[model samples]
Target: MTMLTIDNLVKTYAGEASRRAKSRSGTDRTAVANAAPARVFAVNDVSLEVGDGEMFTLLGPSGCGKTTTLRSVAGLERPDSGRIAVGERILFDGDGSRTTNVPANQRGLGMVFQSYAIWPHMTVFDNVAFPLQVRKRSARPGKREIQERVAKVLETMELGHLADRQATKLSGGQQQRLALARAIVIEPPLMLLDEPLSNLDAKLRESLRYELKRLQRELGITSIYVTHDQIEALALSTTIAVMKEGNVLQTGRPREVYERPNCRFVAEFIGTSNFLRGTVASREGDLVDVDTDAGRIRLESPVRVPVGEEVIAAVRPECFEISRTGWGNRPNEWSGTVTNRAFLGDAVDHIVRVGQGSIRVRGNPAISIEPGTEVHLATDPAKVTLVPVG
Candidate 1:
């Protein structure tokens, strides 16, 4: 079942016009005689469907409209035009003729912002119980019911023992969990998270990532997560929608987007990739041969590129195998000098100078090599991705 659906969503904001104009002679003028106001599409015509019990993420860079899209769904930001629905309920509908908008409090969705947003004056128990108590008399749960629900949620979040502690006295991680406890105490059908773990320390953030995942699975709550961090998106999302310039470029599972990026931007944004530009030399089935600037390279790609057509091969650092001696009779082996190396705790990253280009190779830390030493690099053809030229 579809938990949430956004159809042709668009949100625009008025922006400043150009400060200067070009003259006939190509000289910049102080100001333009008349310039039209800029219309910035914060959320362009984006349509999406989030499945039940799935963690869907809006992944993009800053100012790329991810937060705007999420706010629109939460009813915090009124979109210029679009329709938002949860199951059969219409939360928002706006298109020229008809208009329907639900207030944020009535949307029945849980949201956790970047900040913990905990009330310093309240105890942990009251913080989580506040939402249940504020409801209308007809809809409100009884006092005992609210107590049981709040206690259950706090225990699930591992904050039960701290229920009597002042909200301001909790550690960063505990405070974050308290915020989550308050949100889930209502047991909303859809949860909206906007970079909830970003403010925590690295270790705590990592630990909470798995904790959030476990909570989502055990509680069976469908969630929409927004973040600019690629690793966080990859680690937590069941489905990822990659956004750029107010538009979504691609949506797929984590491994699909990482291993087979649809475009250059996705390949570059999702993670670090070494690109080699070249023209297609030959093709046999899924195998393709490209003559690049560094050397002739072969790769396997399902996308067909005609002979002589320009293309790029994107390879991740971990795909390459580095060694001191050459692997005899290897298919895609090249000898290069190690210009630099970094020990990343569990692994080593070596920057190998291959001809005029440099390729980064990540491998086991035990196989570390000194800089200025010559090393051979080899990668499987299937590991190299052939991206189309824009």
Candidate 2:
């Protein structure tokens, strides 16, 4: 069953207009520009369904509406249009003229912010217990129950030793763990994280990524995370929605989005891709021949490209093989000079200058190759992808 559903969400802000005039070549030119805008859409017609116990992520650059979408789902921001449903309850519905705006307090959601929002004056025990106390009112948990719950959550988060310490005295990682514990103490049905690890150091963030995923799985709570970090999104999310300028460009599993991008924007945004432009010369079954400045190449793409039509093919950096031997029976082969080389621990990156452009190739670090040397690069035809133009 789906835990959450968002349909055609929209948010906008408004602005004013100004005019400017310029003269060039004895001719007068006028331009009208809006000074900001009153109704600037932060999120535009976005829709998604997250399954129960699934980890869904809204991954994009800042100002792409990822955080705005998250905020809208949490009831912190009301959308200008559309509907949001949690389980069987309709949180917000703009259609059918039905308007229901559930308050954030009433929504069963646990939110962990980027900043460790633990109170400096409070002890770790009090911080984690605050939610339970607030919810239970006069019938708060007994001392034994509180202690047991706190101890269990702390142990799960690996911060049991710091339970007695003040929140301010703990390290950045410990504070983050405390924040997470506080959120999970109430055991909300849905979890929302907004760049929770952005404030931590690089090494700490790297280590915490695994811990966060494990905790989320163990708790079995449906989660929606917002972040601009590509590596974090790729490593943590079961499905990723790549957004830009208030619109979702693509939504799919990480591997699907990376391996077979539907458009040029998705191809460039997800990872490094070498784009080759050419005209379709011939087609046979799943194979299509493209005529380029360097030579004619055969690619295995399901997309049917009409003859004489211009198309762009994308190949990942790690997909090509660099070697001194000539292309024996490989379908796609190109000869180029290595313009630059860089060793990146596990792999070596090479910039090969082919016809009109240079392409990046990644190979094993142990494979020795130097700049200014001519090398033959071969790739399986089946690996090449033909994506529609943006």
TM-score of each: 0.94, 0.91
lDDT of 1 by residue, 64-183 (tens): 999999999999999999899999999999985879999999998999999999999999999999999999899899999999999999999999999999999999999999999999
- Which candidate leads in TM-score? 1
Tens digits of lDDT, candidate 2, 133-210? 777456577778888998899999998888889899999999999999998987788889999999999999999999
Best by lDDT: 1
The clash count for each model shown is 0, 8
Provide the lDDT at 114 for model 1: 95
* Residue runs of model 1 more than 4 Å from their true location after superposition: 18-36
Pull out the clashing pairs in model 2: 13-38, 13-39, 13-40, 14-37, 14-38, 14-39, 15-37, 15-38
lDDT of 2: 0.85
